[model samples]
Target: MTDLRVGIGSLKLKNPVMTASGTAGYGAELAEFFDPSLLGALVMKGISLEPWQGNPPPRITETPCGMINSIGLQNVGLEMFLREKLPFARQWDVPVIANILGTSADEYVRLAAELDGAGVEGIELNVSCPNIKKGGISFGRDMAVFARLVGAVRKTVKSAALIVKLTPDAPVAEFARAAEESGADAVSLINSIPAMAIDVNTRRPLVKNVIGGLSGPAVKPIAVRMVYQASRAVRVPVIGMGGITEGRDAVEFMLAGAHAVAVGTAIFSDPMAPLKILDGIRAYMENHGIKRVSAITGSVRT
Candidate 1:
C-alpha cells in the first residue's frame, strides 16, 4: 500500500497536498469541489489583527500563463474568523492552518497568541507583508528583521505549529534558516514575486495597486529552486508553492526537496485542482515504484 502521510515538526498530515492561503477561503468556498478532509491541510485566507477592506478594484489581472494581484491581504479580523470560520473548520477532519499577517511585532504577537489557542493545527506567519510600522517594507526582505519577527512570534505562540511563509525578495536559504533557528516548526517558501502589468491602450496599470504579486506557471521554476535551497538549508520541512496547477507540478516540488506542497492560483480555474494533484502524486509514486510519498523529497538529480 502507498503511504501519503507527511509531517512538519509535530504536525502530521494525512497527505502532502494543502490549499494555499487566499486561494482557499476558510475551506467552505471549495466544499462543492471536494471534501476538505481529503486534503492534508487547508490554509485559509490571510487573517490580520484587524479586518482589512483590501485594495481597490481591478485587484486581479491576467498575465501570460499567470496572473497578478495586490489583494492587499484582505480578510476578516481574527475575531470574525473565530466566531464564523473556526466552527466550520472544526468539523473538518483535516488540519486547518491559519495564515496570519501583521504589520508589526505587537500585532504579530497578538494574532499568533490568539490563533494558537483557537484550535488551529498550525499558524503560517506571512512575514512577507508590508510592515506599516517600518515604512511599508516587508519584514521578510531583511534577515535581521525577519529573525526578530519570528523570534517575537515564537515567544508568543505556545501550542500551535509555526510555519514561516517566506518572501521571494530575499535569499530563501538564509531566510528559511533564520525562521528555523528562531523556532519555526517548518517553513514554506516562494510567496508571489513582485511584478507589474500595464494597459497600453488606456495608459493605466493593469492592477489597481499598480504593482502586484505574480503567481502561476511563470513562477514555478523559481519556486522549485527556492524550495530546494530552503530545504537544503534547514532541518525543518519545506512547503513549496507558486504556479502549481497539477499533480505533476506537485511531484516536481517534492523531488525538488519540498516535503509538502500547496495549490494556489490554480484553484481559481479548477476547484478540483487539489484533488487532481493528490491523485496525480499517487500515480507518480506508483510509476516510480515508490510506496511512500516521502521518498520523493529531494530525489532530484543534477
Candidate 2:
C-alpha cells in the first residue's frame, strides 16, 4: 500500500482527497452515500453570520464540459450550524472544515471567531462572494482588501487553521502571497472562473445572476497552472480544485504542487467521485512506485 496521508498546517488528512464546500452540503446528505469520515476532510458549505436565501430561481446552468452557479453563498446561519450540524459532524472521525464568507471584515471576523474551537479541523475563506459593503465588488479581486479580510480572521481565530479560497479573476499567486503575509496557514485556489451563458431566442442570460462561477473539466487546466504558480509563490499548502473527476486528474494537480485536491462540480454527476479519486490516486502511486503522496507535490518537470 502507498502512504496517502498529508497535512495542511496542523490539520492532517488520511489522504489528499477532500470534497469542495457547497458541493457536499454539511456532510449529512453525503453521509447517506458513504462514510463521510472516509474522506481526507469534509469541507462544509459556506456559512455566514446570518441565513442567506440565495439568489432567485435559475441559479444554476449547465454548460459545455462544466456548469455555472450563482448560489450567492446561501447557507444556514453560523449559530444554527453550531447548534445543529457540528454535533452530527463530530460523530465522524474525519476532520470537518468550515467554508465561510461575509460581506464585511467585521462579519468575517465574527464568523471565524465563532468557528474557532468549534470542533472543526480548519476554516476555508470563500473569497469569491461579492462584498456588498464595497459597491458589490468581489473581496478577492483586490489584494489589499483580501489581505485585510484575512488579517481580521487571523486575529480572531486561534485553534482552527486558516485556508483562504481564492477567486480566479485575479492573479492567484499575488492573492496567495497576500494571505500568507496576513497569517494564513494555507491557501486553496481556482475557486471558479467568472463566466456567463445566454439563451439566444429570448436574448437573455440563462442564469439569474447573469454572471456566475464556472467549474468542471473546462477549468482543470487553468486550475493546474494557477496551482503551480501559487504553490511556487507561497510556502503554505495549496488545495487545488476545478474539474477534477478522475484519479489521473487529481494526480496532475498534485504534480502541479497542490498538497490536496477538492472535488466540486464532479460530485453533481457522481456522488462517490471523491472516493473514486482517492482509489485512483492510490493505484497511480503504487504503479509509479511512489510511497508518500507529498513526494509528487510540485515535482512537475516544467
Candidate 3:
C-alpha cells in the first residue's frame, strides 16, 4: 500500500486530502453524504468572536470553470462553535481544523484562547478574507500586521497547531516568510483572488457585493505558483488549494511542494471528489513505484 500520510508541522495526516474551509462547513455537515472519517482532515468555516450574518443578496455566482463567492465569512461565533460544532466534530475520526478570522488582533487572540481546549487538531488563521470591507485586507496586505496578528494568536493557543491561510494578491513569499517568523506552524495558500463579473443585461455588477473571491479552475494556476513560491520561502509545510478536480491536479500541487492539498470548488461538483482523488493518488504512486506521498513533494525539477 502507498504511504499517503504527510506532515503539516507536527501534525501528521493519514493522507494529503483535506476539505477547504467554507466548502465543507463544519465536519458534521458533510457526514450525511459520506463518512467523514475517510477524509484526511476537515477545515471548518471561518469563525469569529461573534456570529456574522454575512453579505446581502446573491453570495455565489458560477463562472465558466469555477465560481466567485462573497459569502462574507458567515459563521457561528467561537462560543457557539465550541458549545455546538466542536462537540459534534469531536465524535468524528479524522482531524478537525478550525478556520478562524477576526476584525482585530485581540479578537483573534481571544478566539484562539477559546478554541485552545476545544479538541481540534489545529487552527487555520483566515488572514486572506477579501469579502469583509473593513479588516479583510488589513492583516493580509501588510507584512508587519500579519506578523503581529499571528504572533499574538500564537501566544494564546497552547495546544492546537496553527496554520496561517494566505492571500494570493500579496507578495506570497514575503507574506509567507512573515507568517513563519511570527510563529506559524504551517501555512495554506492562495485563498482566492479578488474578481468581479458584469451583468450584460443590467450593465451592473453580477454580484451584489460588487467584488468576490474567484476560485475553481480559473485560480488553479495561480494557486500552484503561489504554493511553489511559498514552499521555497518557509520551512513550514504548505497546504495548497485552488481548482483541484482530480487526482492528477492534486499530484501537481504535491509536486509543487504542497505538503498536503485541499479541495474547494471541486467539492461542489463532486461531493465524493476527495475520496476519488485520494484513491487515484494511491494508484498513481503505486504505478510509479513510489511508496510514500512525501517522495512527490517539491520533486518537480526544472
Summed backbone clashes in each candidate are 1, 1, 0
Ranking by TM-score: 1, 2, 3
lDDT of 3 at 89: 82
Residues 203-270 of candidate 1 have per-residue lDDT tens digits of 99999899999999999999999999999999999999999998899999999999999999999989
lDDT of 2 by residue, 118-143 (tens): 75889999887778888878899988
RMSD for each model, in Å, please? Answer: 0.8, 0.9, 1.7
Which window of 10 residues has the lowest lDDT sum in candidate 1? 127-136
lDDT of each: 0.92, 0.92, 0.88
Tens-digit lDDT string for candidate 3 (1-302): 78889888767799999999999888766787889888889889889988999998788898889888988889988888988888888777888899988877788888888787766789999886432435456588877778988999999888888999998878999999999999999999879788999889998787789999899998898899999999999999999999998999999998999999999888888888889889888988988999999899999996
Q: After superposition, how far is residue 103 of candidate 3 from its true place, in Å?
A: 0.4
Model 2 local distance difference test score: 0.92
TM-score of every candidate: 0.99, 0.98, 0.96
Candidate ranking (lDDT, best to worst): 1, 2, 3
- Write down the lDDT that model 3 would get: 0.88
Q: What is the lDDT of residue 122 in candidate 1?
A: 92
The window of 10 residues in a row where model 2 has the poorest summed lDDT is: 112-121
Which ranges of candidate 2 are over 4 A from the true structure? none
